[model samples]
Every structure is written in structure tokens, then in C-alpha cells.
Target: MESTTWEESVTDSINTIYLLFSAYLVFVMQLGFAMLCAGSVRAKNAMNIMLSNVVDAVVGSISYYLFGFAFAFGVGDNSNPFIGSRFFALADVPNSTYDYTFFLYQWAFAIAVAGITSGSIAERTQFSAYLIFSFFLTGFVYPVVAHWVWSSAGWLSPSSSDLLFGSGAIDFAGSGVVHLVGGIAGLWGSLIEGPRVGRFDAFGKPVPMRGHNATLVVLGTFLLWFGWFGFNPGSFDKILVSYPDAADQGNWTGVGRTAVTTTLAGSAAGIVTLFGRRLLVGHWDALDVCNGVLGGFVAITSGCSVVEPWAAIVCGFVAAWVLIGLNILALKLNFDDPLEATQLHGGCGAWGLIFTGLFAKEEFVIQAYDSGETGVTRPYGLFMGGGWGLVGAQVTEVLVIVGWVSVTMGPLFYALHKLGILRIPVEDEIAGLDVSSHGGYAYVAHRDEGHPRYYADYMRLQDQS
Candidate 1:
């Protein structure tokens, strides 16, 4: 009896430790995001970029907690195929220790994925509009898609999914759900907001907006890389080595394997991003080096669990190439995705999802190791001879999300433009968001000798609205 009790205690402790670590890593990714977006924008906009990240992180968290928690996870009567109808306002959640623990852990994920879109809209969006968008996404869109995969009754769930792909859509780690949703939204958002003023001339010759500080960008990139281990691997329930044969898990193998694949692919992305940048540009750029590491991790997320470590390397390398290309194309298209969210998360994420269909190993599938599947339904990837059906499913999902967000968001933003609520007034845009929106300055204005400063601060401000 004592031995059994001790084992149970060990399992409980392990669960807590894993959950805590994962939560920490995910939470810190926000800082990486802040720094990344900040660096992408001009120095004049740095404070505004950081402030938006901070606000959305806070706002997204509260909204997800208050209503999203239950709607995404609360069980239904046999589980609904579309929306999670049970936990409407987090009312059904109990006060048990597990309930609170589950809430906190899941909350971190909601925050990370929801905030991913902010990078795309960093400089130009209205602060008020962004706050509203974050709440709606966390409370409704992000959660609903999350349920479609993670919830027992969600339509994407293998047990109940009736899609043409018998095993359901194959976004093993939210490539289709989280990254794509944010990417599509970011694309539409950038389009509606339009290219930043002075970003292009009448001929559309691309102009470069050099980032404020490369040092901050590098540090932020490191933080994101550190956090992803927890983000991908921690999606699994915590496993206890002492209770290797416990009902929850047969071993710690899944988590360990996931970490290996995640890091390996990230490494591949780093090298490929390095080479791609060197070959494509005059030299390997620091910004590419920083984001290339991230590009790898994002590319590997979908297949991290199923692919071999070396396959991860290959996937990451390919994804790095994709990311760099997308960034270049984005400039040509006049899409001002300042932080490259559309590339790093959306482009690489899509690549990762498709790769999962190609490289997943057979034994890995049969091991009942996919924490995403909740066991029961085992689907094969291309390497395992599953063929093109799963790939079709993944494509369908990407279209569904992109098409849905575009249709809904495009018009909404256009209407806001008409109403004059989308972008701030021209004067405010010239003044910078820190002073106009956040009511503060991000940096000490340095003196420029012999440079006459515009004395607009003393002039009465006029509201465009």
C-alpha cells in the first residue's frame, strides 16, 4: 500500500512539474513576439508595438478564461460536432484542484496562439479595434477551432469526424487551427489596413524599414525558441516515470520523442535559413538568423510527434526556405506584415501540416503515442503508405479557415475604414502610436544638431472622426 501511494504521489508531482514548465515557456513566448514585432516596425513605433502585445496578452487571457475555458473544453451530451456548447461562461467548471490547474495550463496556449496575429498588424491598427479583435478571437474563433480538434465531440475529432478523410483533418499540433487562423487573419488584416504610408511609391518600388535594434530582435528570438519546446511537447499530458504504466500513459516516451523532433527540426531550419539568406541576399542577415530558428520550429510542429528526428531536420530546412521566400513575396505584394506572422506561423505551419502527411512513421502511429488523438483512431502518413487522402483533408481545412476569416474580416475592416475607426488620423499616424494612443514615449528623443524639429505638439489636435 505504501509503495502504491508513493507511486501515485510521484505521478502527481510529475504532472504538476510538466504543466508548470510548459506554462512558463508559453508565457515567455509573448516576450519574443513583442520583441519580434517591435524590431520589425520603425523605432518610432516600438513602444506602440510592445504595448499592443502587452494589452492583447492581458486582454486575450481574461477573455479566454472567463468564457473560452468552458466553451472549448466543457463536455457535451455525447459531444457536439461543431461548437462546444457546454461551458458557455465557465459556469460548469468545478472548484477542484484539477479544474484550476487545467484552466491555467490551457490558458497559456490560448494566449500564445491568439496573440500571434498582432505581429501582422503591429504599427497601423487602432488600439481599441485590436483589443476588440483579440477578445473576439480568444472567446470565439480560436476556442471553436480548438474544440474542433481537441474536444471529444469536435468535428475534427477522429472518433466522430465524418469528413472524407476517415481519420479526420491531420493538424497534429494546431498547424491548421492556431497558426493558419492567425496567418489568414493577419493577411486580411494587413490587406485591409493597407501598406504603411511611404512603404511604396507610385511604381510600387519596395522600400525597406530597417528595424530599430538587432540586439533586441536576437534576444526575443532566443526566448521564443526556448518556449517552443514547452509549446509543442507539453501539449501532451504530463507523464510520470514512476507510473510508466499508469492509465494516463504507458511511458514518458511520447514527450521525450516530441522534444527530440522539435529541436532537431528547429536546428535544420536554422542552417537552411542561414544558407538561404546567404545565397539569396548579399550575406546572412541577423534578422533571418533570429527568425530562421523560429521558422524551423513552426515548420516541424505538425509532424513533431510522428516524424523521425532526421526527418524533422529535413522538414525544418524546407520550411526555412519557404519562410524566407514568403517574406520576399510579401514585400512585392505590398502586404505590410511587419513581423512576418504570415510567413513564420502561417506559411511554415501549412508546410508542417503537409509534411506530417508525408513523413509520419508507421510504428509511431501504432504506439498510441499521439497525445493529440486521445488514442483509438490511428491514421497513417505518406511515409507509412497512407497516401493523399490525409493531404486532401489538410488542404480542405486550410481553405476553410483562410476563406472563412477573409470573408468575415475583410468587410468588417472595410466598414471600419468607412466609419473612420480602422486607422488613426493622419496627424496621429505622423506622431506615432506611443504618444497618440498609449499616451507615452518608448524612447528618449535624441537631439539632432542643426535639425529643425516640427513643433506640432503645441498646435491644437484635430480629430479626423
Candidate 2:
């Protein structure tokens, strides 16, 4: 074999560094998920929720390593539009120079997507069953969606002849593939597990089950927002080291635009959610603010590189409304989503894809795809003189993804339910998952003092003693 050139070697090293750093940032999202879920539940189940968050990373990694990467990004003629058939145990993956870093980066994404389902099914789910679900989710369900949109041989890819229309499905950082897929899975899991014991009264009225800690929820939201800088801008990985043509000139434009769009959208959505709640409910709700920030983050993720700043703001604004509307609709429909995962991830995720079709710019889409003018089929936005073709494609993509996830994950949960392991016994649930599942309370103070103490109260007690 011929020796590699020094220039090629140096570029590969830089790309590897870039991806590793981005993967680290994405890995921090695991802590965000832990804090968010732990704080969202009652104190009695906090440990269980936190454990599930950590387990998502642990089990998701192994499962994805076993087969997820293969299904997601595998190559070769055997790799079809629907699924990849190679690298089941990551066999021969080390042969390629770029494979390792890419695998780690995508592994982070798989774990993050798999973690989304944990919150909606929290409080009453069996710990063993959750581990199983997370494994399959990373290994198969999530990878299939990633393959469908992001893989070269994917039928939904703009480059694929099998594509329905337009530029095929643009999901910059997986608003649909990651967020929507997990959202629908969470919805199915929640429906299968049924509501918590007291989620709804006999009259069918929803009861308020407030989270025990608002501080952790807000902190988790901030962390997730911070991590998104990597999520959106790092997706510009392709162009960062591979500006091969004049059309690829100034590729950093897409990266910088992505960062700006992400920030503006999150900020706009947060403002809308915070103030909107005050206007509608007579006071600001911190929980709503946290969810709103996340909803904004999810909404702009798909179009951050393709849309203008103003369009990103619109996406955030619309995303916050979608979140609020879905929260109400879920409650009215008797759905029990503890962290509002369905609304924050599912509803906003679909909106993100739709908004991309409405606002994506032709030049940026060209820049983002890195194939110059020929890379994408229907590159312009509906409002950007591109007409309705892209919009039609986006809507179809959303429906197809939603249908696929629902059909696949719904039955997975149903099978688990039939095995009598999906949900824990009522007595164990009423008693609290921390004690029942883990054999201890999250806070020893609560066990010792017989009542939970606020931080201020704890300080006061220390002073008195």
C-alpha cells in the first residue's frame, strides 16, 4: 500500500481532535439528563430516575457498540436503504482512519436519543425493563432512523433516487432522527405503562404532581443549552476539514450561522415560555421555563445551519407554542408524561423539520450539504422563492418518521408489557422506586429526619447545633 501524505495525516488528526472534543461535550448531556430526570420526579424516586439516566449511557453504549454503529453508518453493497448489515460487533471498523472518532461521536448521539425515553416512563417503570428498552433502542430502533436520514444509502437522502422529493430530509442535528424518534418512543412507553397511580382522579381530572426540585431542573436546562453549541456547530464536521471546492468556500459560514441560530432560537423560546406562562397562569412557572428552553433547543436543531437568524427566532417562538399546546393537550387527553418529553421532544421536533422547509436558505443549504449546487435537489425554502415542494417533502418525512417509530416502538413496549415486566407492582410504585428498586433513599437526611429539609433549613439547623 502507498504511504499516506503528511497533509492528509495532519488533517485527519485535526478532525479526530475536533470530533473527540465534540463527543465530550455531548457526553456531558448525560449529566444534564440525570439532573433533569432526578429533579422532575418526587424525592422518593429521585435515585431511581438518576440511575436510569446513568444506565442509559452505560447500556446504550454497549448495545450500540455491539450493533448500533453498524446499522447506522455501515457501508458496502450489502448496506441497503433500510438497514446496514455489516459491523455487527464493530468488526473491521478500526481499518478506516476516520471510523473511530466518527463512531464515538455517533455513539454519544445514540445514547442521548435513547435517554429521551427515560423521563416519560419514569416513576413507575421497572428498572430491569428499562435497561432492556435502552439496549434495543440504541442497538436497533434509533440506529435505523439515523440510517434512514443520515446514511449515504438511505432512501430518504437527497442523493437517493428513492427519495420522495426535494432535498430529501434535512435534520441538521437530528431534530427528527434523535428528538422525534425518542419522543414517539417515549409516548408509546408512557401509554403502555399507563399513568402513575394518582396521575388522574376517578373523574378523569388530572392531578398536579410537581417535581421536588426546581433548582436541578433549571441547571439541567442550562447544561443542555451549553451542550447544544457542540450539537449544532459540530455537525458542521464535514465542511470543517473538507472544503474541496469553490462551492464549499467559506464553509465556516454554516458553522457560525448554526451557533447564532441555536442561541437566538433558545433565547427567544425561553422568553416566550417564561412570559407566556405569566400572562396565562398569573405567575411565572420555572418548570415551564426549563421545558421551554429545551423545546427551543430541539426546534432549531434541524435547521440551525440552513436557516437565517430571523427564521430561527420564528422556529423558537413556534416551538414554545407547540410545547404549551401539547402540555395542555396531554393533560386533557389523560397522558402522563412526567417531564413532558412528548411535547418538548416530539411536538417541537416535528415543528423543527417543518420550519426548516419554510425558512431554509438556498445558499446555506448548498453550503451545508457541501456538494455545491448538485448536492441537494430542492434546496430553497417555501418562503424563499422555492415554492411548496420542500414543504411537502418535510411534512411527508415527519409523518413517515412518526409512523415508523410508533409502529416499531409501540409493539416493543407491548411485548414487554405482556411479559409482566414493563411496569412494577402497584405497591412497589406507591412505596417509591428508590426504596423499592434500589433499596435506599436518595437523601439519607430524608430517611433520618423523617422529613425533607430545604437547603436554608439545613443551614439553619447546623447554626443552631
Candidate 3:
């Protein structure tokens, strides 16, 4: 008995350390989001967007701690399918089923949702409005969705006693719960705010308001790619459990396979986008390639653990076209999103869910959802002959996510717009939010030295001109 207890203790310790490392890796994605936003916007608005990204993490931390986590996973004997009902403010936390490391990992996911929305309304949004919506999103709107899909008590959870269509939604790493929710919320916000000032011409023609730096976009993309290893494989939440039938194999194998699928999906999408854009626009664009890579990642996130690596490649390949097609539609509709947050996360994210329903392997599903212990077989991929139940569940998830986010975030943005605080003033936007609102540029060419030399040189140059 004592030896058994010691073994369990070691396993628990190892699992805790694994979760903590993954949480730290996810936290690094915040930096990636900041850099990506900074490079995607014009130089004049770089400071504004980067500042919003910083505030997203800070505000998300407090709100998720106080309310979001409770709403997402808190449970009791009276647990309902719609929401969590206990553990507010981290009370009674570190319980048998969850620990502080779990909270940290979840908090990282909460902030990522907010980060996605920030990219949609990047340059022309009010900072005060950003704060209000960020808190609401992290604290209330997003948590409800998380509860529906992730919580054990959730109706859509595979672990639920009563699963949706006897399978529930296989959002293994939150293609719908995180990416779709964030992307749909962003869609509403962008629609209400309309396009950025110069994004469309007078006759409704599209204008290419290119970002100032391609180097930063590339850098941010790579950082996000590195962070995704943690985002997908880490969702397993544990690595010590052994499969029932497999000898000397366990969740560790699934974790490694998840990582491989993530890599192949993103790589395939990037390559496809590179060539696709060349054919479409007659140019090799690095920015488009980067966005395509992210779109593929978003799409495969739902099935990274359950789908084969080859299926992941197909997911990414289709995801590239989905993103490209959405971009074209956005342009035609005169809808401007600086980072393509809605299309990449929202559109490709939806595709990812469907892909899971179509390609998820039965054995992998049993391993991931049932821990390979339950003898009961569950519905799986339609194309794999597992049947329509899982695909139906996947479709249900997509519809509900779209409906839920639209219902919640749509009205909030509309209310802010009615109050005249949703968007920045025209003059502030025209002069750039940095100068008009933030007090300085992100990069300064000349600084006042408390001397006449700089002023005299400036005056001479002005006179010459």
C-alpha cells in the first residue's frame, strides 16, 4: 500500500509539472499577439494596438480569476448543463480534480480569446471601450461558452452523463470554445465599427492599406507557432495515464501525435497559401503566408489529437482556401479586418470543427475521450464510417457558438456604439491615435534636448522647404 501511494504521488507531481510548463508556453503567446498586432497596424497606431494587447492580459487575469473560471468549470451536486455554479474567486480551489496549475492554464486560454477580438477592431477603437468589452468577454460571455463545451456538466461535453447526440462536440483544444467564440465576437465588433477610415475607396473599391513592417509579422507568426505546441498537446491536461489495451503506451503518445498534427497542418497551410496567393495576385506575399499558417493552426486545433497527420494536412489545405475565400468576400463586402481575425479564427475555426467530425479516428477518440478504459464505443468521424452522430454534434456546436457570441457581444458593441464610445473620433483616427490620444509615436525620430539646436535646425529645414 505504501509503495502504491508513493507511485501515485510521483505521477501527480509529474502531471502538475507538465501542466505548469504548458501554461508558461501559452503565456508566451501573449507576446506573440502583441508583436503581431503591432506589425499588422500602421506605424502611427502601433502603440495603441500593442497597449491594448498588454491590457488584454492584465484585465483578463483579474476578470477570469474573479468570475470566468468559476463560470467555466466550477461544479457542485446541483450542477446544470448551461453554466458552472461554484468556485468563484478561486474559493475552495486546488480540489482533487483540479489544482492551481489547472487554473493558470485555463486563464491563459481566457486571455487568448480577448486577444483575438482586439485584432478585429485594432486601430479605430476606443481604449475605454476595449477595457469594458474585454472584461465582459473574459468574465461573462466567453465563460458561458467554455462551460457549454468544456465543463463536465456541460451538455455539449463528451464527459457529460448525457452527451449531445451521444458523442458531444470534439473540440479537443477549443476550435469552437476559444477560436470560434473569439472570432465571432470579433465579427460583431468589426461590423458595428465598420472598416478603418482608408480601407475602402470612395466608390467602394478596396484599398491596400499595408502594414508598416513585414519583419515583425513574420517574427510574431513564428512565436505563435512555437506557442501552439503547448496550446494543442497541452490540452490533454495530463500525460501519465496509460491506455487500456496498448502496452507501454499512454497519453504521452497522444501528446506527441497532437504536436505532429499541429506542425503538419500549419506547414501545409503556409505552403498552400504561398502558392495560392501567387496565383491569385501575381506576387509572393509573406503576410498572406503568415496568416494562412495561423488559419491552419486554428482549424486543426479541434482535432489535433484525434485525427491522423494526413487528415491534418487535408484540414490545413482546405483551411488555406477557406481563409483566402473569406478574405475575398470580406473585401467585396467592404469589411475590413486588419489581422483577418474573423476569417482566420472564425471561418477556419468553423472548418476545423467540421473537419474533426469528418476525419476523427474512432480509436483515437476512444483514447482521448474515454481514456481507453470504457468498453463503450462512441460516435466518430462520418467519413470513417463511425456515423452521423458526431458530425451532427459538431454542426450543433458551430451554430450555437455563432448564435451565442452574436447574441452577447453583438448587443454590447451596439450599446457602446449608441453611447458614442465604441469608435474613436474621426480627427483622432485621421491624425493617428498615437499622436492624438497616446501622446507620442512608437518610434521617435527626434527628441527635444532642452536646447535651441534642434529647434533651430528644424526651423532652417522648414524655411528651406
Candidate 4:
């Protein structure tokens, strides 16, 4: 009995280690997000991009660790309507539940969403205002939604199904909660913040603002794609709740379905975007192509575990279409999306969830209900006449989410605007964040001849207005 008990203890320890490692993979995506922002910003503001990414993750995670975790998972049982309330500062997590593992994983997600907002408002928004938003948004709004979807007791829990309520939304990862919410919030920020000083011409037409480094964009995009493998499939609450007698399948293939669809969609989006940009712009844009891959990944995230192999390819193509259109609209509207957050994460994430409604086989829905089954039968797509019922559910859900985020965020931003604290002083904006906040220059792009002097002249014209 003694020997057997010792072996069992050793095995349990290993299981805990594996779960933690997988969660670590998910955490590293924040670095990927940071790089993506770096790739997207203008050369002059590269430090700004890097700083926002770094600080948002640090501040957002700490804020979440402090209180956000409890708000999302504090409920005592599977049947609670509200988020867990007892875990403020994470005080009550049972030791048996791998306590900090859940905290660690969910915190990564919160950081990612907060990081999404960073890019949208990067160039001109004040770091002080950003710090404020990160505190409230991550610690409150985001956790409340996570509680709704991922928390068992929340109203949208799988066991709490209602067509109108969109319970068990099959988000797989976080199309609605993370990406979509970020995107809508970003849209609001961009709208109320308005374009950067000269992002638009006097005629209100768009002006081109190029990212500093195509190579950085490509590398950052690749990093995000790689990390997504851990993200979508890691949605399995099963990882944390291990069965004592269950068979071990290393890195489960049901999770592979999520990986497969995600990769396929990203690839399809990349190809389509490259060709589309070439056909339209007369030159293929590496940055646009990067966005395409990201767009596809976001598009497939919701439906990844719910769709068939072929459906993934189709989904990717469709998501690319949405991405291209939204990006074009942003430029035309003079929204200076420093990192294209709205089109890539917001637009694609919303579509991905709707795609789940269209492509998810009824059988898969049943499987997701039961917990370990892959629900291969449930992956039937609209091509097979899955019909408008699922489609309608998706449409309604997307509209509600978009409406919920936009309506609330828009007003919040407008109020922030009235207060005049939304942006940094003009001198700070010109100096870049490294010099302004960190007391050092991050990248030497400022070393290029005439950059500061260049911006200085431009600032005078704007201030004259």
C-alpha cells in the first residue's frame, strides 16, 4: 500500500506539471502580441508599441491576479449565475484544484485582450490614460464576460442552454470574449480618440501610415500563429480536472482538430490576402498578408473544435474577405488603427463564432456537451444543409456582442474625451515612449537624420489649427 500510494502521488505531480507547461505556452503569446504591435507601429513610435505591450501585460496581469480572477471564477459551484465572488485576491481556490494554474492561464487571456486595445490607440494615447483603462477593463469588464462563458455557474455555461441566451456558444477559445470584445473596444477608442494628428487629409480622405518593419511584422505574426496551438485547444477545462483512471493521450487530438482548423484558416487567409493585395494595390504587401494570416486564425478560433477539415479552409477564405474589407474601410474612414486590431481580431473573431453556428455539426454540439468526445458528426457545415437555424443563432449572438461592446465602449470613450485626459501632451507624443517614460531610447531609429526635426515641423502646423 505504501509503495502504490507513493507511485500515485508521483503520477499526479507529473500531471500537474504537464498542465502547467501547456499553460506556459499560452502565456508566451503576450510576447508575440507585443512583437506584433512593434511590427505594426510607425518607426518613430516603435518604442511606444513595445512599451504598451509590455506594460499592458504586466499591469493587466497584476490587476487580474489581484481581483479579476475571482470575478470570473469565484462562484462556488457549477450552477451559480454570477461570477465567483469569493476569490478576490484569489483567497479561496481549493488546493486540490491546481489553484494558480487556472489563475495563470486566465491571466494570459486577460493580458491578450488588454494588449489588443494597446495597438489601436498606440501612437497618440497617453500612457497614463492607458494605465487606467487596463486597470478597469481587465479587472472588471473582461472578467465579467469570462465568468459568463467559461465559468460553470455563469448564465452562458454549457449546461445552461437556451437558444436566445446563446449558452454554450462553442467559442472553443475566445472569439467573443477576448478577440471580439477587444476589437469593439478598439473601434470605440479609435473613433472617439479620432485619427492621429495628420492621419487624414483636409478632405477627410485617408493618409498612408506605414509600419516600421515588415520583418518584425512577419516574425510577430508567425509567433502568434505558433502560440495559438496552445490557445484554442487549451480551452479544455479537462486539462485541469484530470481523471484518476483515465488513459493518457499526449497532447490530445481532439485538441488537434482545433489546431488543424486554425492552421488551415490562417494559411488560406494568407494566400488570398497576398493575391488580393497584389491584384488591387499593384504590389503585394507583406504587412497586409500578415494581417490575413492573423485574420484567419481569429476567424477560425470559435469554430476550430466544431468544424470539419474542409470547413476550416472555407472559413479561412471567408474570414480573409471580411478582413480585407474592414481594413479598407478603416483607411477610408481615417481610423488610424496602429496595429489593425479591429479588422484582424475584432472582425475575424466575430465571424469565427458565426462560422461555428454555420459549420458545427449537431453531433459536435452533443459531444461538447458531454466533455471528452470530439463530435465528428457535429462538424457538418452549411454545404450539407445544416440550415438557417444555426446560422440565425450565430447572427443574433454576434449582433448582441457587437452591440453590447460598441454601445458601452462608445459612451465610455466619449466621456473620457470630454474629460481631456485621453491623450498625452504633444511634447510627450513627439518624444516617443522610451525617452518620455522609460528615460532611455529603445530603438535607434531616432538616430536617423532629421526624424525628430521632421516631426517637430509637422507638430507646429497641427498646433496652429
Best by lDDT: 3
Q: Which pairs of residues collide in model 3?
A: none
Q: Candidate 1's residue-wise lDDT over 276-303, tens digit each?
A: 8899887968888777888788878776
Point out where model 4 deviates above 4 Å.
1-15, 77-89, 161-167, 239-251, 372-393, 426-440, 445-465
**For model 4, what is the alpha-carbon lDDT of residue 181?**
83
Candidate 4 lDDT by residue in tens digits, 233-324: 77663443332234453224466677788899899999999998899899978888988998898888877777787888988898888988
The lDDT of each candidate is 0.73, 0.84, 0.89, 0.73
Models sorted by lDDT, best on top: 3, 2, 4, 1
Per-residue lDDT tens digits for candidate 2, residues 1-465, read 999899878877877787777788888888888888888988878989998988899999999989998888787765778887554846626466577778888899999987899998999999988888999999998888888888878877654666556567788898999999999999999999999987898999987788878999988988888788878888866544444456345556567878999999998999999998899889989889889989999999988998899999999999999999999899899999999998899999999999999998987877677445444445568988887767877787799889988888899999999999899898677667887778788987554221233445533543454
Local accuracy of candidate 3 as per-residue lDDT tens digits, 251-345:
99899999999999999999999999999999999999999999999999999999999999999999999999999999999998999999999
Error of 1 at 248 (Å): 14
Model 1, C-alpha of 318: deviation from truth (Å)? 1.4
What is the lDDT, from 0 to 100, of the residue 326 in candidate 3?
A: 99
RMSD for all candidates, in order, please. Answer: 5.1, 4.3, 4.3, 4.4
Q: Specify the poorest-scoring 10-residue window by lDDT in model 2.
A: 446-455
| Predicted model with the maximum TM-score | 3
**Against the hidden reference, what TM-scores do the models get?**
0.88, 0.92, 0.94, 0.86
